[model samples]
Target: MKEKKSAKTYKPLQILAIGAHPDDVELCCAGTLARCIQRGDKVTIALACRGDSASMDLPGDKISSIRSREALHAARVLGAELIEMGMSDYGVDLTLQAKQVFSDVIRQTAPDVIFTHYHTDYGSDHNNTFVLVRDAALAATVGNFRTSRPAVSKSPLIYMWEPLAGYGFQPEIYVDITETFSRKVKMLNCHRSQREWFRRRGGVDFLDYIEVVAKFRGYQSGVRFAEGFIPLKNWANIGARSVLP
Candidate 1:
């Protein structure tokens, strides 16, 4: 098989994928992260919380710790760094404090591109994740945002990932993940507890459902496997071609 081209053609970019919970990024954009890693780009996985509420049957703290470990393991699988924002599970709110924390992460990382949840998602955390990232992405570029860290040199290109299956998500970009799909699945499998939680609580095969979604997205993009995103277009996004898939 031919080796994939390193992402060296474009300037090395810091890419951040933020989600409401540990498994959210894995379920949505792990394939894209894996591809970025293959191409030698820097990748960071940020979760709004430790996903403690993912399984209420277990103690919250215990599940939070377990989920954090799982998130770290998944990050390793994709050669990315994991950043936990320490919000309580099912408790993500669109508050000033939350915005500050989210802004701090963006400024500290100085990412060139950000992928986050779609604001129209069913879950509150998912919807709030979108709001927080959108606001923080803007605040991170302003000198007077009053965040913990210094402002980023410029705002990054922000893109929102596909929402839950039934949500009204219309994708404007599609990343072909044909070569990285297996690794994406492997990374998602690191959340072993989530799989068990889904079965016991939701009665769903987690991996199976995600793979099906990936396949469906791939079909939309004319690829064997793919991930879809909608660009959060604005003045900052003009002429930013390096971040596009």
Candidate 2:
């Protein structure tokens, strides 16, 4: 009998994972990000919003402040740096301001790969972020595109993390994440403020749901735990490297 072929492994020099809110990155792709960091890849975590409007009990600015701190802790746990784009939580849009913010992030990070929300996410902010990041990723590579910073010589490979709603997302690939699953949960626990929000919604244990999703995706791909992703299409020959195994 023939032995099974090994999955492709990638050690990208740098990776940036962007989320619509403070905890979105942890909820979606923290395992993958954690794995990247373990392999000595420099990882940068970016959020389109400070998650200011996520809670009504706290004022917008206060919520933003709290979430920013929480995000920093989470990033530290994952061995990644954090960048908060300072957009409103639910008001993220595909405006010029958003485009420029995302472009600036791409230029500043200069990551070999970027992971962000899927275009078809159920949340308005998530979908809008997808639009801006997609545009900005392209804009960051254009020499004539006047951004605050200089353009990068090349655009990084972009991957869509699984959507928050999970209903409409069609994952095309899976990365086995058995080794980093616990660390991913620990990283997510850093977002202390969001616990009540999830607790009130479906009475679901947030961490358990995340683990279950990873396990389900892993089962689909013959692994013990995993994170799924769908590559952005229509880009010729870019994003061909596999960062997940």
Candidate 3:
């Protein structure tokens, strides 16, 4: 395919996580992002949605602004760059137009690794997120797509972070974020809306719940805390030497 022509430049960033909602990336892979930051890697979180339609209490638009601001906070806490696609929160339909938008972002960021929601997710937004990211990343390398965005040289690594626990899911890779547990907490704390939700009315402690999940996943990696993901089978490379075992 003829590569697209552009004046845009690519960065040697190590990681990028795309989420269906504003906070999804932080919840799913903040720990991983934190670890990458510590290793001097440039990490980014691209929000697929502005999160305008995500809420049971606060007004969607109001909550959306709050969520957008909070995402910057979470990204700051993890020392990662955060970009929102500015798409409607729950209006992510799988389409060529959507793919074009996603492809543009991919070309702009030029990430080395990309993470998004699993396709078999509980929410339609999350499922569509997977489709969008997959198609976008693949299209980002093709020039014939005729996008204003420049085509990236190498295809970024693609990974899918799981939904909440009790979803009967498993991870193909676990990043031992023991050293970044505190940073993870810092990132999660930036999610003030979530804290207010479960803390004020729900009368439940989500922090404690996430603590257990972090520890459980960490245990699998023989660490203090961790986030897990299932790497895309075709996109990920493997060899005897690549096996963790």
Model number with the top TM-score: 1
Query: For candidate 1, which ten residues in a row score worst on lDDT?
Result: 236-245
Q: Tell me the lDDT of candidate 2.
A: 0.84
Question: How high is the lDDT of residue 87 in model 2?
Answer: 79
Q: What CA root-mean-square deviation does each model show from the true structure?
A: 4.3, 4.6, 7.5
- Tens digits of per-residue lDDT, candidate 1, 1-245, equal 99998775666789999999999999888888888887778999999987877775788899999999999999998889989999987889999999999999999899988998988988899999998888888888888989778888878888888886837887878999999999988998999999999898878887888789888988999999888988887776434585654
Winner on lDDT between 2 and 3 is 2
Q: What TM-score does each of the candidates earn? A: 0.93, 0.91, 0.86
Q: Where is model 2 more than 4 Å wrong at Cα?
A: 1-11
Q: Given candidate 2, what's the lDDT at residue 101?
A: 85
Return the clash pairs for model 3, or none: none
* Model 3 C-alpha lDDT per residue in residues 64-117, reported as the tens digit of each score: 899888889888877788888888866889988889988888888887788889
Which has the better TM-score: candidate 1, or candidate 3? Answer: 1
Off by over 4 Å in 3: 1-12, 198-204, 235-245
Rank candidates, lDDT, best first: 1, 2, 3
Candidate models: Cα lDDT each:
0.87, 0.84, 0.77
